[model samples]
Target: MMYKNSILLGTIGGYRDRFHQFQKDRSLEERLEIAKTIPRTHGVEPVYPQDLGADGSGAAAVKASGLAVSAVNVNIKTEPKFRDGSFTSTDAGLRAETVQYIKTAMDLAADLGTDMITVCPLIDGWDYAFQADHQKQWGWTIEAFAAATAHRSDVKVSIEYKAYESRNHIVMPTMAKTLHLCDRVGAPNLGVTMDVGHALIAGECPAAELAIAHDAGRLFYVHFNDNDRGADWDMLPASVHLWQTLETLHYMRRIGYDGWVAYDVFTRTGDNVEAIASTFEIMEDLEKILDKLGQDTIESIIASGMPQQGYRDLVKGLL
Candidate 1:
């Protein structure tokens, strides 16, 4: 089967912490070479500033790693809190700092030939009170980001959402809310970074969510991983919702989503490259399944209201 758009398949840099034990202290350049060696890899490598540090030096290190800075995940709080309305004057100040940091990262990403950055609102811990604080600062963060990204058309912003893991545990954390935040901020470059693991945790089908985002035209980036009803984030793909993973990819193909498929997994051991590659291979196999299933049959199954069974049969037939 011939794929049309160039899908940017890459792993997050944090994988180094998992794969190489003694190489943990390796410079960003060395780590990046390992990351860049992966097949069909592209896009800017993701840097978690809180884990790595936020100075300009971090950005320089990302560039030196031979990987473009695809995006960065900035931690909003050092510790998790259960209360809301925690947006102290200090909190606002920290928000400002985050905006400035994003601007710097965008500049560096541009220099390194990447154009996307992800900003997470808050860490896990805040309850409804935290949601309230998020609602309050949401507007400010968007406005600040819009202004920061106004001059840089190539750089886009994605809001990463999670349920219960890192605060803001709403019964249903919808992309609609995320898109609402972007609309309120009124930034053309802002979009949603849909993480399939979170969607499953929220008890929503990842494929349906992708369809919704595609219909609304708000999807910008994607995080590929799997989770079972009892599992937490970063679980292996095949172990959790194997069919849904394939269905999600089929839906992405139908919607023509040509963004990066970022592996955002965190394991206890940290050598997730094998797992990451396995996940990619699963996705690739799913692609071939879709090729054999054909668009008409796939669409018919999606339209037939038997998505789960139909998708499973489709995969079974392919195998």
Candidate 2:
């Protein structure tokens, strides 16, 4: 699975829907057709089970599009019942429902010929101190994930983490923290979705974190976007954090991360197609610069333990 320059780029239909919210709800096929217009994009990541019709027609529509299914993102955060939490909720019934939903998603993903399922328990956290029992909630969350993945070892379950969304503090908030949860779950299929913007907000160097996840054998997928290091703005790729995003992509090359490099952007006020094209254009430019740098030179820089001097010299040499 050597992704290299041929990284299977993808994007979300939800972003398209949100961008066209003032218009009308676009069907999965319509969104898939829109994505097909973008160059270099080979897939469309549709929301799971919800998008998959009861008669399997929705999955059939996606398959007919001839676009690959990147991964099925099981949404668990929007309902009123999940206002407090979902997997870690005190209500046993709600916990059971969440686990069951994940299992169904895994089965559907397998059916769709995709070997991955992305589960982000975004609602499993608190906005205030003492609002929820931390220790107990952690236990439930781990158990729920373990149960979900235990159903099928063939399908990988990647948990996307964020510092805060739907709450002041999210449970799996950082790369290290999410990796710790993966360890506790003790499931071989469990991994992390290295969303770069979230990593930046978590105060982590995205390249280093990518290396950590790859070394741990837990880097499943990557969500590409940019932000001002203050929020998960989901802006276009390499928009604000130019150097950091470049370093992150360089490390992706370094580790041979052969996974779907998704263009998870939010273009609320911009032309969706142009935004997607611009992202690809920027990626192409940055990748060309990286190609000029060459893998051997990058390896040499990493080999030198003094990263500060290596980076300084590399920049000066480029100039």
Candidate 3:
């Protein structure tokens, strides 16, 4: 099948973490200006409220940079109040506050001209067994999301699932669990952001997860990064698991995913611009490799169901 390649590229504004040595904290505008300098990126994702600046200056700066607003990330784990949990908190008052916060963020996302908002429940799970009430917490989590999207169905909420980060464990830790949450929430606008690093850490096939979410019609967004199967270091994409990342890209093309593919790399040292540019360069190379592999060859391999034959041809092409 002849396919036209078209995908909007984006990056998280805060991925440019400042290291005490080489990098320093840059204002939101400065970061956005840096993002615009990246050739492949057409947009920058800024976290709501904090990254929006005091008087819409941050959003204005992004606008002035001629880059699109990919999405606004709603941070639920960073604040002290959400240490236990936010959406599924047993503290009713805290849950109320969390719901209100999301609503406010939703409004901000609309104002930013991007209907997408990412919700990463990084603190919504327990580290130990018997620490969380499974049924009750599940209900609360679903209710909070439902309430957030009830008023405005147009604003899509994409939940980014990570196995763990802030807490020893995170709630809704996998695509299957996340898609189940979306179903339970029963909101048309509720979807998911499939982060490749998280998928690798979760021991999941990134390509399969992408296909699953798309089949469910809940694949709202994507974040591309790589990590050793051990931890979410948020390294450059295709850095660790080359073949798996390539296969993931293959499936992305197979499904005709034209949505935003955001680079979600983070660093505590080294030049952030170079890191981002390097990822873009790697992506350019991967795209060329993918072009050479072609959908027809991949399809034939899948059809044959014989791994050795496919491997032989793939090795020949590489050499």
Alpha-carbon RMSD of each model: 4.8, 3.1, 3.2
Candidate 2 lDDT, 1-319, residue by residue in tens: 1441111222333344433452234567677777777777766666655677533568888778787788888878877877878898999999999898788888878887889988778888998888889999899989999899999999999999999887888899999999999999989999998989889888999999999999999999888888888888878877788778878988887777777877667567656666777877778888877777676777788789747978886675445
lDDT of 1 by residue, 1-319 (tens): 2222111222333333333632134455555666665565564444545434565466666666555445665444443331232222136655556566667767655665666777555442345654345444555555665766675778886777666654545322567677666677677787887888877876778888888877766787788777775534576654568778877877787777766767655554545555555655666776877788788887787689876888586757676
User: What TM-score number comes out for model 3?
Assistant: 0.91
State the lDDT of candidate 3 residue by residue for 1-319, as single tens digits.
1222111222323343234343466677677767767666666677755777434456676667676777777777777778888988889999988887777777777877888888788888887899999889888988898899896877898999988877777778899999998998889899999999999989999999999999999998988889998988878888888888888888888888877777677655677677777877787788788888777987898888858989787666555
Between candidates 1 and 3, the one scoring higher on lDDT is: 3
CA shift of 72, model 2, Å:
0.5
- In every candidate, how many clashes are there? 14, 0, 0
TM-score of each prediction: 0.78, 0.90, 0.91
Reference-based TM-score, model 1:
0.78
Please report, in order, the local distance difference test score of every candidate based on alpha carbons. 0.60, 0.79, 0.78
Whichever of 2 and 3 has more TM-score, that candidate is 3
Q: Rank the candidates by TM-score, best first.
A: 3, 2, 1
